[model samples]
Target chain A: LAKTTQPISMDSYEGQEVNITCSHNNIATNDYITWYQQFPSQGPRFIIQGYKTKVTNEVASLFIPADRKSSTLSLPRVSLSDTAVYYCLVGDVSNTGKLIFGQGTTLQVKP
Target chain B: DAGVTQSPTHLIKTRGQHVTLRCSPISGHKSVSWYQQVLGQGPQFIFQYYEKEERGRGNFPDRFSARQFPNYSSELNVNALLLGDSALYLCASSLIRVDNSPLHFGNGTRLTVT
Candidate 1:
């Protein structure tokens, strides 16, 4: 499994775009990049997943470089509600499908 | 459709004691995985069960174990718990036991070991 490193915390103002980058230098061949969001006390929610290049959804967008060494989760026009911890995970495909998590990036969107 | 659901919203246990947490996955989900989340940290994978068989286990000790029923409901059991065992136990369900499937998580059972 590839270990991921992200910013410990980040601050942003409302209506601004936020891009959080995650680095996984040793990503495996079958690893897929996925991002999840978690609030104060709820379970982590799936935001986006991409194998390569870019994947855009209604909530966010994920961009992966050709080397797959790093990825960015971009949230457009973020609001206060976007204040939460965002996790970037390298997909585990060893038949276990067990998820590995890192400290994650705490994004605080303020007004 | 309902998302994953876990029972015993909150629990408090003593050292050397044991605890069991239950989870009901979405109506048609067939794979269930368990995770432990400490305060201010991300969720750590514990175990994964699919079609009533154990598929994966994490770096946790022998005290941590889990199983999935034929119907896809799952149970996480911790024996001889320690203070460090106090954390949120989460259950995630996915439609299949494949790597590409995104996991749907439950609110989780909060366990406090005193």
Candidate 2:
């Protein structure tokens, strides 16, 4: 399993864009980058996933570089409710059932 | 359709005691995975069961064991628990045992070892 490192916490104001970067220097060729959002006392929710390049959805966007060593999760127009712990995971989900999570980046959306 | 469901939203146990936690996967989901999340930290993988068989095991001790039923429901059992065992036990279900398959998680059962 590839380990990931992310910022412990980030601060942003409402209506501003937020970008959280994750570093996985040991990422494998078969690994995919996935991001999840978790609120207080709840399970983490799937936000976005990408293998390379950029993948965008209604909720968030994932940008992966050619080296696949790092990825960024961009949240647009943040709101107070968007405050949560964001986790970045790298693995080949097609082959394994286990997901290794790091400490995660706590994004605090303030008004 | 209902999502993954776990029993006994909260539990309090004493050291050296045993505890059983149950989880009912979503309809048609064939894979169930268990995780333990300590406060202020991310969740740690414990076990994964697919089609009533053990698919993967984490670094957990033998005291932690799990089994899946034919219906795809699962139970996590812990024996001779210690104070460090206190944490939120999470159960997630997926259509398959693949990582790409999005995991549907329940609110999790909070276990407190006194």
- Which one is best on DockQ? 1
TM-score to true structure, per model? 0.97, 0.97
lDDT of 2 by residue, B32-92 (tens): 9999999999999999999888888999999999999999999999999999999999999
Instruction: Mark the 10 consecutive residues where model 2 chain A has the least summed lDDT.
Output: A90-99
Candidate 1 local lDDT, B4-110, one digit each (tens):
99999999999999999999999988889999999999999999898999988899999998888888899999999999999999999887745587888999999
Model 1 residue A1 lDDT? Answer: 83
Give the true-contact fraction for every prediction, in order.
0.69, 0.66
Model 2 has a DockQ score of 0.65
Give Cα-based local distance difference scores for all models. 0.92, 0.92
Listed in order, the DockQ scores are 0.67, 0.65
**Candidate 2 falls in which docking quality class?**
medium
- Against the native chain B, each candidate's TM-score is 0.96, 0.97
